[model samples]
Target: MIEIRRSDERGHANHGWLDSYHSFSFADYYDPEHMHFGPLRVINEDRIAGGQGFGTHGHRDMEIVTYVLDGALAHRDSMGNGSTIRHGDVQRMSAGTGVMHSEFNASEHEPVHLLQIWVLPQRAGDQPGYEEKRFDDADKRGRLRIVASPDGRDGSVTIHSDASIYAALIDGAEQAALPLQAGRRAYVHVARGALTVNGEALAAGDAAMIVDAAAVTLEQGRDAEVLVFDLGALNG
Candidate 1:
């Protein structure tokens, strides 16, 4: 089954300094039907104003992944990790037990656009951890590159979850495909530009939830950059 979720169908919130779209129920944007997909709990596309961002916050039993798309993002965590991540960089924080963190735009003049994802851990109460890696455009051009996974395979950051995240950059005549195993599911999100996923057209902010499918294919893209989540079967 393939279900297309339009860009405008997501829950939106704007707080002057921040504009965000939630792919699943989050904060004040509640949707019983869109609570989650498998272990993938949250996918928030956010744009933060220059020099403004989220203050110290707390999270537990969740694997948080940050992907910067446009500008830079400064991050500080209870794990004593502090750094700035720009485009093509992926940051993963396992808030096992508990953790405090803050994120702000690294630039005073340029807004930062990014995607914040939360995945449920395979087992709760594990030790907290952090990891960051960079996947240059050349690494993903015309192909899917694993960015985050349970095993950290292919130079991808490790996540304490039963899911794998893939990134791709494709243009005209370029394509990529990911084969799905039985009982596995896939969620494809277009970060920017336009593309065709498994024959379904998608634009920036749009997503395709797939289940019981053989594979996910991307083609006929127009400067498209996308993220794909290979997830386990839905949990009750």
Candidate 2:
């Protein structure tokens, strides 16, 4: 079964300095029906004003992944990790017991657009950890490139969750496919441009929640950039 979630159907919030769209129930945007998809708990598309961003905050028992689409994001965490991530960079932080972090736009004049994802950890109470990696456009062009996974396969950032995340950049005549094992599920999110997923048309910000499927096919892309999540049990 595959269900399409339109871009406008997501919950939206704007705080002058930040504009965000939540794919799942988050903060004040509660939706009982859209709480989560498998172990994927949150997908927030955010645009932060230049020089403004989230202050020091705490999280626990969650695997947080940050993907910057445009501009740069400066990050600092309790683990003493501090750096700036631009487009093509993926950052993962496992807030096992607890961790404090802050993220701000690296530029003083350019806003930063990004996606912040939260995956429920497979097991709680592990020690906190952090990892970052860069996947060039050439690496993702016309294919689904693994960016985050439980085992950190292919140099992807590691996450303490039973899920694998893939990124892709496709244009006309380019296509990709990811075969799924029995009982596995998939969530496809279009980060930019338009594309067709398993015969379903999707625009930027759109997503496809798939289950009991044999594979996820992406094609007929119009300068599309997408992320696919291969998930485990639904009760994460």
Give all candidates' CA lDDT scores.
0.96, 0.97
TM-score of each: 0.99, 0.99
- RMSD (CA, angstroms), candidate 2: 0.7
lDDT of 1 by residue, 1-236 (tens): 99999999999999999999999999999999999999999999999999999999999999999999999999999999999999999999999999999999999989999999999999999999999999999999999999999999989999988899999998999989999999999999999999999999999999999999999999999999999999996574
After the best TM-score superposition of candidate 1, give how far the Cα of residue 8 lies from its true spot, in angstroms: 0.2
Measured over all alpha carbons after superposition, the RMSD of each candidate to the real structure, in angstroms, is 0.7, 0.7
Total backbone collisions for each predicted model: 0, 0
- Which segments of candidate 1 are over 4 A away from where they belong? none
Q: Give the range of the ten consecutive residues with the poorest summed lDDT in model 1.
A: 227-236
Candidate 2, pairs of clashing residues: none
